[model samples]
Target: MLFYTVMKPLVQVALRVFFRQLEVRNPKRLQVPGPLLIVGNHPNTLMDPLVVAVNRRDPIAFLAKSTFFQNPILKAIMESGNSIPIYRRQDVETGAEKLTPEQLAAQNEAIFGRCYDYFDRRGTIMIFPEGTSVQERRLRPLKTGAARIALGAEARRNFQMGLQILPLGINYFDPQRFRSDAFLNPGPTIRVADYADLYRQDPEAAADALTEEIRQRLEVRLVITRDAAEDELSQQVERTFGSHLNPDDDPTTLYDNFQLSRTVQQGILYFEQHAPARLAEVREQLSAYLSELRQLGLTDEALESGRQRPGTRLSRAAKATLRLVLGFPVYLYGAINNYLPYKLPSMVARRATKDAEFVAPIMLVTGMLTFSLAYVLQTMLVHHFTQDWRWTTLYALSLAPTGFYALSYWNNLETRVHRLRALRLFRREPARTAGLLRQRGHILQLLGEARAAYLAARTAQRA
Candidate 1:
């Protein structure tokens, strides 16, 4: 408890610094006081728990796979983070295959006993019902451990122990990328008391029912697709339409994109059921537009406003040029000062791991360590050369803000470059640019028409 108390603030700070935008929706849903079980999808391995843990006001104990505790260092870290390990049959490696069924039962029984005790004390526990992490839009089949644990604990206390199971949907916008966004959407709480009578009669049936309910609730909160292909198309459509809808690139744009994807999926399903041919035509148009965008090296934003008037184009170009000219000196200084610390994590992660899901956490932890060490070393060098503690302190303090400025400057520079390329294409190849613009306009028109038709069909069905 003491260890968790000490580390919570630091962990929260680290998470805030790691992700560019972390939004928690419906946080009030978690405010109910009682024995709580946080169940969520596992998309990123270690990072998933941390994201949830840091967001909540109360500390949450997590059930982690026992395999992670095999390493002494990891075991210590997990223990410090208030994690309980559960042995899984799939996690047994090599020699562990020889373990008898009795032994496995004994281990899990002990874990469950501990869980019941924790719940009795009105403590909060987090479990990934899916049991494993995978980067996918759809939720995998959830295991019954979470439900069983909650029900078991409540049963032990004659259903007097108020246990609430909160379903959360963790949505990552490019999970593996640095400075990506993550949204935590909390669903309504499932009260264990509501199912106490059923559990008393048949425990297994009650567990299954609760598990299915959790899955259904999570599915609603998540941006789940039918399959991988649909997921891919949804992402592409999101990127294109998002640029159109969210021109300023607000932080909430990611969540907005998620909602947009859900609507698109429904529209596609509507077409699949009633108008397959129309759906195919719409898909082809979308694919062709995306292909043309790729070929021209242009983002959807480039086509927004559809071949902007010459005056507007010139005005935007002038502003971008002015920003570049004015910000260059500060950007240069920041780049030079922060370059090594910034680049090392990405360089190392690219070489070290093949799994894309692991990359962001690796980069975040690695960057935290490397940047801190580098800053200290730079401070020491500055002190050594100038022989003034005050100058060294000033230099050390400037590292963070300047580094932040460099990151902002880099993003702005990239935007400017993209706009410049679009402007140049507009000037050099007017006919081709105009053709692409017309194609984009046609695709948007088709999508809008299809959406209207789908909505009309739904209205007619209801009528």
Candidate 2:
């Protein structure tokens, strides 16, 4: 656990840099005492554990696949960080064969015993019940491993351990993107003592019941899409028009946006059931509208820009230009000093993995190495040249803050550039510009009508 203590603060800082917004709904759930088990949806590989672990007070023990222990360096790291490995069938199967019933029991019993001992110390453990990571909104069917572990650990002490299972929904706005938002929605604890009677009767049945309970709690907390097409439409609506719908969206926490996303998914399902034709029309039109914007080198924001009042528009333009001018020197300094470290990680990640879930962790691990080494090497060179420790320390300190500033500056600059493109298009092709604006307005009208109809149907059904 010495390794965990040393790395916890560093991981906390790294997470803050990686994600733009990390909001936790009902944060008090995390402060609950240990002998606790954290169960969460696995959307990003190694990122899932770090995101949950960094938020809590004490160290969390994780269950990793036995394959990770094959590598010498990773084995040492995992051991020091209090990780236990369990064999997976996919890793063991040599051909197109499968494991027999409860095939992993023999292999996992020792691992389970390790967990029972951990709970004896009143420690916390985290597990992904889904067993594997997949980068999608939909939660996969959970294995009974987490449920069984909780029950076993409790029974090892004859149900007097006071153990609790914490179910968490890890909601990601965009799993693969670099500065996307992540929301942690935690469910209430499931007391292990509540199942003591059932477990004593039939252990297997008790495990199944506990797993179903976990599934229910996690379902309510997550925004699960039915299929790929549904996911696509919901994301499109949320990205472009969500704010208009949830105008009073809470600025402090992302729970409001989470609610909006869940509502949007329900709306999609409702339309598909009640008026498939209308839904299809909307989908087609939305696709066409987006295609037109792409061909015209514009975004939804650009069309919205055309509607701004002249005085407000000019003031906004002047302010954007001033920000660009004033922030240029800092941006340049950060780019020159930090660009190599940032770019190398992404390049390495892309080359290393084809799986969507693996991308984030590879980039994260690669970044941890690249940035640490680059900063130390660069700082030494600066010290050698300056012969002044104070100046060198100051330069070292400025690297991270300026790096973050550079990122923000570049993102805002892109927004300004897109708006300017809209202005230029209006001046150069007035007829085409007006046509696109009409198309956009029509799409919004269609969406508004559909929402009204859905609400009416929903109200009438309730009545």
lDDT of each: 0.82, 0.88
lDDT (10s digit) by residue, model 1, range 1-463: 6446786776677778778888888778866565899999998888888888777777788999987788899889889889999978766644434356788778889999999988888889999989988888779999999999999898888888889999999999888877788989898899988998889889999999999999999998898887887887767767777555334555544666667767778777888888888777767888888897778776777656336788987787788789888988888888889999999999998898988777877887788788889999999999999999999988998888888888999988877666767777887988988888887777777777777897788799899
Residue pairs whose backbone atoms clash in candidate 1: none
* Candidate 2 error regions (>4 Å): 95-104, 456-463
Q: What's the true lDDT of residue 150 in model 1?
A: 91
Error of model 2, residue 296, in angstroms? 1.8
Q: Across residues 243-345, which tens digit of lDDT does each residue of candidate 2 receive?
A: 7777899878789999999988998899888889988988988888888888877789977986788799899999989989999999999989999998998
Q: By lDDT, who's the top model here?
A: 2
Ten-residue region with minimum lDDT total, candidate 1: 244-253
Off by over 4 Å in 1: 1-3, 93-98, 243-255, 457-463
TM-scores of all predicted structures: 0.94, 0.94
RMSD of each: 2.3, 2.3
